[model samples]
Target: MPTLTALSPEILAKYQPVIGLEVHVQLLTESKAFCGCVNKYGGEPNTHTCPTCLGLPGALPVLNRKAVEFAVLAAKAIHCEIRETSIFARKNYFYPDNPKGYQISQFDKPIAEGGWLEVPTAEGGTKRIGVTRLHMEEDAGKSVHDGFMDSVNRTYIDLNRCGTPLVEIVSEPDLRTADEVFEYLTKLKEILLYTGVSDCNMEEGSLRCDANVSVMLKGAKEYGTKAEVKNVNSFRYIRSAVEYEIERQIGVIEDGGRVVQESRLWNQGEGRTYSMRSKEQAHDYRYFPEPDLPPLVVGAEWQAEILKDLPELPEARRARMEAEYGITPQDAMTFTATRAFADQFEAAAKKAKSPRRVAALLTSEITMRVRAAGIEMEASPVSMDGLVLAADLAESGELSSKMLKQLLDTAFANGEDFLAVYEREKPQQISDTGAIEAMIDEVIAANPKQVEQYKGGKKTVAAFFVGQVMKASKGQANPAVLNQLVAAKLDQA
Candidate 1:
């Protein structure tokens, strides 16, 4: 086993960390990638499979047009250069889950390449990670193992996910830290969700990531031995796996041990990587063209049509929202993280008449209330129109910040309109100076000591007088009007 040493500034200055990522995003098509069987997961064992996906003899594979279009859209969103023509090749391998003894995937000519995605760093800056290639492939069946039987082992196979369309996006080694990996995944997931290409939900296994991590002498010209961490399902796991692997490699070098090139599985429970098997080089897979399926030819007209349907992506939306709404970049990023959230924000802003105010409310008060109610932005009872009404009341001086919060709570809980609830509550404001003056006189006459204290230069006692007058009015008095009346009466004294 190889041991690593902690690199000091002197050693660090001679080394660099090179990282590359392979992301598998399952497309949201209605059918399988190469067959007409429904492309679903978690069904009964072998229920979703057909002759083609099962690799039965004489069963032929057919391409899904929608899947192809989705791949094209995804490539365009990432700013990849789409080729006028691309081909699919058969990657031959033997495994229990691979019934066909081969997997159909892109080998030489992939769909997209040479793209760039900008990720944020912990230091409040952005790093652009270059994308090397984006290719499509078919998924394999899942295998289930049971140890209940002592004598005979039980093994079950589910083919529901088999033949499902997948796009494997390979990135160049541009990331330097664990934070960069997290940011890259975050930005990538956001774009995929916004484009409607995939749900990108890791919990459901719709999206997955594999990282190639290696470290070398700080300024070394060549790279060190690399380890591939497979199937990191969550963002937290990605960070942990990468950090652990970096340290592990460094320890190997420090102890003068050679780091083996192999594939490792992330044992989340143990918080370490365990060796799975030796990693295979490209030639080991023995790639060859599939005689069954013809080359995929994407013409200029088809690519152009898909390009026209692409919507405004997250980065552009964030920039526009920050510039136009006068919100901070962080706030703008939050608002536009999801398409539905961005749409809701814009609609509410138009009605609220104050984009900045609406942004603040959504990001803070409304968000807190919604989370407490166990609702997401899409399912929240507070609609854009309802928020607009609340903003209107606050802007017109009809409600204070405190009152507005109350109104929002009630509105979100019962789906009641803001004005209707305000009417029922009938929170009153002291608009009449005469009425306010009368209330102030009664308080002053009742509390002579406090009144004398105010006259003797204790200005802080003004708040006490305001509280008394507000309390006497049952807390319905308008604070602005009460302040004016209190000041005028004090001046006379």
Candidate 2:
């Protein structure tokens, strides 16, 4: 390829990037998918392995019922069509992490297929992203390349993760931008969390994503050669990798060169994707049905039983919250980041005079303080009841904004609840018109120059008087009353 340069706006706008994400979410089952060993993330290397997971001769594999239930629950939550009968196929491969020469996974007939998620767009609208399939499979072991004195020349394999149950969610080539990719992943993760199937923790290898990127001419029917970018640890890095890969493929075609299909690694440090191997060199897997296990049957009765109590999904909850609370779309999103948090917010909103006020205090005040304290929202000194109290007080004009801030600060600093701090301080708003007018009079007499400026059509000077009076009253004056009193006093003067 010729030396790459930044493309002009016209050239950049001539092509559209198509991105698909493959997300692997480990199930939170108590045992391995096909074994009796404990299913967990960290353990002594190789200690969690057994004959079945290790693929020992004549060691039969038995499926875990809990894994199937979890997988079905997740699939239903995403609106996938659950198959009545799915077969387990042996995906043959040879790698150090693969204790078995082949992986037992669903091939032609996966557990579920044909789902869609409504992804929020930058234009304040939503677009449906198609889910190609959600299939159940076992996970491979970890390959540790560091943390040893001789790690520079050695590799370590930990089989604890081997045979752990997983569901790989593959998205259709529908994402057009990096932001859409992010929104799709976020929505998917949120749905999964709401279903309580998986934790979706990217840091602990419980969740992982691989992005396939390709670009095509604006009106082209066929997509350009696609490259799979792997080893991206977080959603932010995945977005960056997809962007870099799209540009690279575009650059190749613009340089009179054909884009090559290959697997690449995302180098976060360098902010680029580098080739790992060509698609031609990739393994065939030689998939075939597993002879040991019979066809897994999830009949309609069982499917209904599994999904009968399905929790309301994230999107549905967000929409309902927005309508019920009369809160903004942005606040709805924040409140529904987690199912538990959403429940807590709703409970408080129901008791408070204004649900919008509760939402405001949460996103604007409590969220910032909780994050700054490096604590979880559940651990915040402000409980849901406390939040309700604060919201009610603010709505009733019993607490001024400044007074509220002071009380919140003291609560956070003293490690006490908001109600405790409020009761101790007993801060009251001065809504008495006469008292506020008296303070305004003093401020007006003290600053004749500003008073003259106010009367001389410099109407903006009224703000100075309001500030002076507010300061003199120590922020106790009700803001609404003070503003009205100041304007009236200014007009009279």
Candidate 3:
């Protein structure tokens, strides 16, 4: 086998890569999907298992109503059509962590089907990617491979994640490029997070993605064999893995070789993917309806009740916030990155004198300070009430830009809210025009050379006088009033 190098643009453009993603999102339920065992992450091994999850004889499986509601909410977020009835099947598989020997999942009939997400394309357009289905299922336990006696040779099974409620979202083969896949997954994750169905913490495994990638001639009607890429922990790495897979497949075909269907693991350390095992087909799982559990039903009435809990999604909320608050699209995106953040901004903006000022403070001052401190926005020293006060002062000209920045710096430095620092510092701006004119007169007398330059068609030199006057006022000069006074005084000089 020849070593694979980067393919040229012409060779790459000759083939189209078809990508489909399967995302498994763990719901924020209190208990396991079929049992009453706690569904929290990170506990002692096998401590969260029950008879049903452990697959003990005579143990019967029970459906969790909350999980169903959450699954339906997630499905609706992606615009899927909710089915009246869906069946749970026994997907037979053998693994060290799957104590049940057969995993219970939805097959044939799923809870929802046929949805689409409109993602931004690289060409500055939106493309709709179809979602094949969103089905309810349970997660298998984890197998820890190291950090124990004989760690390298022996594997440890932890069933803490066993039977956790999950909703698997499968996307259609509509992605043509790695960038498209990244955009699609990003939009999907945003929608899921906004719905509050799952935390979508890729590191904690609350959300996981497996991508199926294949490449064929641009005009070919049939798709080439696809290799499923798994174990990619982040969206960025997923994009890289798909890129490498596309090129590798193309390279093989260019060398008169065929692409094989297999399961591959992305080695983030090596920046490439390696074959894991042969890909399993639907028949390999031998899925059959579970004898213990009956068909799950989510009627229209139940769905309507669940729909009430669905908050405004990201895209719609971003547009509405942009219009209502007169914020830029970028600011709207920043504010609405999470529902809680958007709610906080809206509540504060309503009370503030100027919503735009509030937007400016959030995107510039507060965000920068919070990031610098390496703390979450919620943990910022400045609260929403504090923001309202600051914005009000700035809008009413009670606080100049310099004053606000200094006050914000003081607040962050002292670990206090903006109101506390403002009240303590009592830094009042020199808005009195008579006083400003007096200072401007002093600045003009001192900078006679610059003053002459200002009068000699060098009007831009007026900034020198403004700076001198602001210094004379000890950085307390009202910028708007100071600018007017300085320009008028310089022209007179």
**Of candidates 3 and 2, the better by TM-score:** 3
Give TM per candidate: 0.91, 0.87, 0.95
Give the Å error, residue 354, model 2.
1.6
- Candidate 1 regions with alpha-carbon error over 4 angstroms: 1-14, 148-153, 280-283, 371-379, 409-420, 423-430
Instruction: For each of the candidates, give the backbone clash count.
Output: 15, 0, 0
Ranking by TM-score: 3, 1, 2
Quickly count the clashes in candidate 1: 15
The segments of candidate 2 whose C-alpha lies over 4 angstroms from its true place after superposition are 13-16, 121-125, 146-152, 368-378, 428-493
Q: What is the per-residue lDDT of model 1 for residues 219-326, given as tens digits with 9 covering 90 to 100?
A: 577888898999678999999999888878776776678788899999899889989898655446678888888888889999988778688998899898888888
> Between the candidate structures 2 and 3, which one is better when assessed by lDDT?
3
Give the better candidate number (1 or 2) by TM-score.
1
Please report how far candidate 1 places residue 264 from its true position, in Å.
0.5
Distance from true location, Cα of 150 in model 2, Å:
5.5
Q: Candidate 3, residues 29-146: lDDT per residue as tens digits?
A: 8999999999898987889988899998999989999999999999999999999999999999899899989999999999999999999988899999999999999999998876
Residue 115 shift from truth in candidate 1, angstroms = 0.5
Q: RMSDs, each prediction?
A: 2.6, 3.4, 2.0
Query: Candidate 2 on 1-493: residue-level lDDT in tens?
Result: 5333576667778899999989999998999999999988787899999999988899999999989999999998888999999999999999999978899999999999999998878888989999999999999999988656764667889988999999999999999999899888888888888888889989999999999899999999898888999999888998888877877888899889898889999999988889998995666999999999999999989888888768988778889988888999888888888889888889999999999999889998998999999998889998899989999999999999999999999999999999898888889999999999899999988999998998899999988988999899999999999999989988888
